[model samples]
Target: RPIFWVGNERTTDHIHSILTESEPWFEFDTSRLEYINRIKFWRYLLGNESFDADYWLTRVENDFE
Candidate 1:
């Protein structure tokens, strides 16, 4: 499995140092943090058994507008 590091420059630098010390398919970048967060949010919502469809629908509509 590959480990992706997505964060600001400082954090990426820190993670790069750690990964260099214990390398394991590391890929570091300082971007797409927002996209990654949205992916995680949707994954959590879809995976939850007690998902609130109405709430998320309203939230998504509001987010788009």
Candidate 2:
């Protein structure tokens, strides 16, 4: 399984646009996509703090907050 790392929501949108506009044959596996917080990962890797798993999950935006 290949992992697609999307830095932020904007990047995700950009990738989607490219895929929709150019590559009609490329099919992405949503299950292998990893959305992570780079800063959090850096801090954790440096032993600054523990890893935050919650931050890595996609934060869905609903019509009603």
Candidate 3:
């Protein structure tokens, strides 16, 4: 499946209502850093604080139109 988020990085203020109601989401314990063909990636689990979730809704709309 494809995954994405919408808006600026600070996105929790938008989706907390829906996400907080359903489950006890947990943040990753460590950064997901890896190397692929000498290219390195660094991903940290800021949990809800990570990406702008509002971006998700926007993406859906974009796809629909």
TM-score, ranked from best to worst: 1, 2, 3
**Each candidate's lDDT (Cα)?**
0.40, 0.39, 0.30
Q: What is the lDDT of residue 56 in candidate 2?
A: 34
**Candidate 3 residue spans exceeding 4 A from truth:** 1-22, 25-53, 63-65
Tens digit of lDDT per residue, candidate 3, span 1-65?
12366546544443333332332343332211111101111113443222433243334335542
Evaluated at residue 19, the lDDT of candidate 1 is 24
Query: How does each model score on TM-score?
Result: 0.26, 0.20, 0.19
lDDT string for model 2 (10-57, tens) is 333443232223234434543223223443455567786643334333
Per-candidate count of clashing residue pairs (backbone under 3 Å): 0, 0, 4
Best candidate per TM-score, number?
A: 1
Ranked candidates (lDDT, high to low): 1, 2, 3
Clashing pairs in 2: none
- Pull out the clashing pairs in model 1: none
Candidate 1 Cα misplacement greater than 4 A, ranges: 1-31, 48-65
lDDT of 1 by residue, 1-65 (tens): 23565444333344223322422443443223333444446558679533332243344435542
